[model samples]
Target: MLDTVGLTVAEGEVYRLLLVTESASAEEISGSCELDTAAARRLLLALEAKGLAYPVEDSPGWFAAIPPEVALVPRLQRQSEALEQTRAAVLEMVQTYQRGARARVGGEAIEIISGAAALRQRLRQLQDGSRREMLWFCKAGYVAMPPESNQEQFAAHDRGVLYRVLYEQAYFDDPGSVDNVVEGVRAGEAARAVPRLPLRMAVSDRSVAVLPLASPGAPGSPRELKAALVRESSLLEGLIDLFERYWEVGAPLRVTEEGRIGGAGPEDAASLVPEDRHLLSLMVAGLTDEAIAGQLRVSKRTVQRRVQGLMSLAGVATRMQLGWHAARRNWL
Candidate 1:
């Protein structure tokens, strides 16, 4: 550790030997300090350069150590001064790097959000900070999240913050899915449905967008969670435009006290639209309301209402009876 004083090992040993022996020839320093004569001479030269040792006028190769207060203290002071200069240089470089980072706008417009918990936290933060509209596009994918997430959206919807959501037909396959859509509609959410949605994305107030990372097949699974956060930029605007284009074609839906609500029309269960029929197939396959809602990216309430509509048309009080009646009537 004492080597920080700028003394080489041999030089320190030779200096210490000189302090004990008072005066010594290179040979004496080598023998006393367990160093070779040439190494001893080199060590003395290094000490002399640091003003720690001085050569004898009468003895050409002999040396003496200066007192510690006069020699060691001065060398340590010089090292400390050099260290201070190094520290100042490093601080200046850090400041320069940070300034450059600030000057470059859009350099970090997109950030990768990894881990399930972290993505949830950031999503909630973005949602809470939203002051205007929220746009969502959802589809079948691998992800596990809190079931109560939609409750938060209800509060946002109540505050005059518009919510527009697009979902896949697969969403309505579950029981109770219709109730969520019904409640959301009651709370001022403009909900829509389509056969399928491409990605899962959430845009908050036209200011930020969050989406899962693009994957070859499924977006991601809970065990290997990954997502992205994007700030306002050319890319963000493009995403906004994409949402609008889909919104244009999405079938608008609302809940009414009566069995009838507007979107696509068909008179009976046997004459249900292809999308509604697909939902019936999922229900007949026995997926639960929550699972169907997750797969279709719709609310559990929405799914339930659709099943109720089917049951009403089939004149079946039970889901099992509706499934049997749909089959007998050749309803796909």
Candidate 2:
């Protein structure tokens, strides 16, 4: 099939199974082809639509396969026509956009782009063109701040782009933070950490904001950090509002006592004179004993002892119960 009609391996397997099985239902084909039933059904429908498979009208959910030689010609012809139609539609869209862009950019303009290299080039242009600051809130472990050395970040920083980044607390513990710090120091970028962030984001000078799309490989792949950028100031303002809210609650990124990035807050340290209220606050914030120790530069045993003392003070058997009691009393 690959040599004759360029069918993919999975497609060929499904086609062969249908051909050999006479008249099989989607479930049967799925079982024979080692695919999910729904997925098999979709493929079978596609094959039928392309004339490679014909539905058996008398049989409730059965399909008959057409021989490859008989099926390939019509299928390929249909595909070719579909591709030509798509190409024309795309070309018309490009022309329409170009005209709109030209009219809008009479002096300065915004451009929409697709494809990897084009997107990268646009990002580089934006970063290079930025005069003031670049602000970002990123997922804990995913985005390697400053990306690679030779990437757009370093180049933008070289051109004097001040960067302020907020990261999730977990990211500090990730191996990627080392690269983050190395590139950050080299680029003179400032960064902070928060325990958790709502979503991934990047904004530049209130002129452009990038937000992640939820779909897989949406704007692009997660590793690619694909995002949609809006140049509209009103929309950018809304994004900035959200960014500031998360920034206010986020922690500063610091090397922990354990020599890792990020830890609990200062109020969580057992070495500090324990204020029952402060300890309760830390607990409510979800800091573990180890995190508390790292934050306070105390032994984890000390944190455990303090927690136990606090638990006994509250007359609670479990932390959740203790937290509930505290919350009920408005302690946190």
lDDT by residue for model 1 (18-46), tens: 89988888898777756788988888888
Model 1's number of clashes is 17
Candidate 2 structure quality by residue, lDDT tens digits, 107-148: 222333434444455556667777888887766444323344
Residue 321 in candidate 1, Cα distance off native in Å: 30
TM-scores for the candidates: 0.46, 0.44
Per-candidate total of colliding backbone pairs: 17, 0
**Lowest lDDT 10-mer window, candidate 2?**
102-111
Error of 2 at 139 (Å): 0.7
lDDT of 2 at 147: 49
- Candidate 2 TM-score over all chains jointly: 0.44
Candidate 2, residue 78: CA error in Å? 55
